[model samples]
Target: MNPNDRSIVALVMTGHGLVHTYELSIPIFMTAWLGELGVSEAALGAVVGAGYFLFGAGALPGGVLVDRFGSRRLIAGCFVGMGGAFVLLGLLPGLWGLGAALLAWGAAASVYHPAGLALISTGVQQRGRALAYHGIAGNVGIAGGPLATALLLLAFDWPTVAVLLGLPALLAAVGAWRTSFDERAAVGVHDAPDAGHGEPSPRPDDRAALWTRSKALFASGFAGVFVLVALSGLYYRGMLTFLPDLLTPLVTVDLPIDVAAGRYVYAGLLAVGIAGQYVGGRLSDHARTEWALAGALAVLAAVAVVFLPVAGVGTAALLAVSAVLGFFLFLVQPLYQATVAEYTPPEARGLSYGYTYLAIFGVGAAGAAGAGGLLQIAGPPLLFGALAGLALLGASLSGGLAVRRARVGTHP
Candidate 1:
């Protein structure tokens, strides 16, 4: 990669990692929240879901902001918002306080996926490999965030950890300010009439024009892509939210004797996701992204169906299920990301990704509450079954998208 491409990816990758670091870290802290806050799983789940819901729900406007302003500026703003939110989390440290901080975080983090992914889709030359590397960075944060939180809990309290975690976001904001790169270096201004000079063409002023843009985008098979991502998100959030708690009982082998075993297993699952993202991103470059997405979703469905059964056999069995769960879980991300790039117009890419996350994180936020309630009442088998059902639905949708792409030809 040239210096500019490297710089752009580095900025985005770091920012992406930090976003998820804070994201995944919340679940780890939730473990403490259970006892500290004196809330039932169902109640805490709703609270967590509310925060995540806002995080996703805000992406629509955030995408508009990205198009109106620039990704760099919005990304900087995201860092500030997230950092400040975490600091607030440190101060409040109550159930209501947690919800408020997460709401702030959701609003802040909602800016990232659209801004960062739009930058990559527009800026990078080697889009596929760049996405692969970018996804790896995210996996690092996803895996490391909880691990870091778990490790810190061994020493400091959750409140202090929340404050310490905020530091990285502030640092990333500094990096964003210092970093320099051409945002539209790869795709160029000519390819995007409204999208050159590091700014999008002015957004449509009237509802009719806005509707026209949305209609055109969905007509291009992005509708399928959107639904696919939502399904994937449902499974993603449902599986991840309570995974540490769920695995706590299954852990038999001895560890550091200080930390909760489930937290490490959770981190390890995310660690394996690094490879999953690499392989998925690489595959997207070589084959139709939708096709690869279908296959991955299929594997996920199988794993979800078998997860509880496989996990119950022994510690080894549990670890085995966890590893597969981790790998294919993240593999879906880049595939859907690449598909969004292929299926949407470059000028409205921000809006496109906005809807994507709206589906994934917003609608998918329901999974947190759903998983929690189900786990409390119906237990793991039912929870895993519900997850498997969602994955199967996603796989079917992806398969349809793959077939649609085969018949219709690639999007412009």
Candidate 2:
């Protein structure tokens, strides 16, 4: 890719990363918010879960807008919407107000997957690596959200902290407004002998082509991939949402120390996954895509077996297992996302990514709610067991997809 392409990728990534940090502030500051608002635990959980559900629900329509309008405009709108949502949340009064604010946040957050992924697909030539960098930016944002919330909460109340979260989105909105990219614009409609350089053609009647290719892939093995990704999403949300809660009690340290230390430890572990994303990206750029995904799944399976059994595992051991788990789990995200990019035509990139992320966010929402219920009943052992089972099934499903993808390549 040239300097201009690189510059565009960076801008899109910055916007995406900033958007995530703002969207996630609610979960990061949930405890503090609940204390200030005097809400019950169950109510807080429900509200947070609703935010995730709304975020997923909005993705399909967000994709439609991305397809109709352009990534740049959609992304710019997302930034403004998310910033406005956070500002609303900061100024709102009660639990009802919180719910309304989260609804807006979810709707705004939904714009990222379609807009950001479409930007990378259209603006960059080697999309695999570009997508990986995008994933890295997201993970970095994920890590930063809690860290920022933690720091801000110390100085300001939940409302002020929320208002502060809006700053990044406001800045990103400005940046996104200035950029432009259109897949059809870059590659014109031209009929010629195979451009032996091996690039997917820009489809004529772009929207119709998008529908055709996306529908075909959905009917083919793509459905199976969606199931695997949904399960992967559930496992991730279940594990991350509950892991610290589960581990904190087992720690012999003070409450403040345990929560504080655990948060950073988990964030550090998650940071390792950035490497995983980059590795998957580089491998997908050249190798069969499934290999990178399979590697991640296999590692996650092994991590589950070792880490899930012991409830009171020491800090050092927890750190080690968490790092490996994070590496495998968070890393597979880009690989799955890139699969949508590689399989569909460029015109459908936005819709394909939209549906993929919809599955991810939807499953994650269910996992978040169901995990809370399960934790109450069977405790962490059963919960981890169930998640591990889901991971195992996802692995089997991914293996099947890989074999089928290989066969299609050989015969075609």
The TM-score values for the models, in the order shown, are: 0.87, 0.80
Model 1, 241-345: lDDT tens digits are 888878877887777575667887888888888888778768877988777888899999999888877888888999888998888998888788888878777
Off by over 4 Å in 1: 1-10, 117-133, 174-207, 345-350, 403-412
Superposed model 2: Cα runs more than 4 Å off: 1-10, 33-43, 120-136, 174-214, 253-260, 282-295, 305-311, 338-350, 403-412
Best by lDDT: 1
Q: Give candidate 2's TM-score.
A: 0.80
List, residue by residue over 64-179, the lDDT tens digit for candidate 2. Answer: 67767877787888888888888888888888888898888888888777667656655666666665577567777877776677677667777888888887788778877775
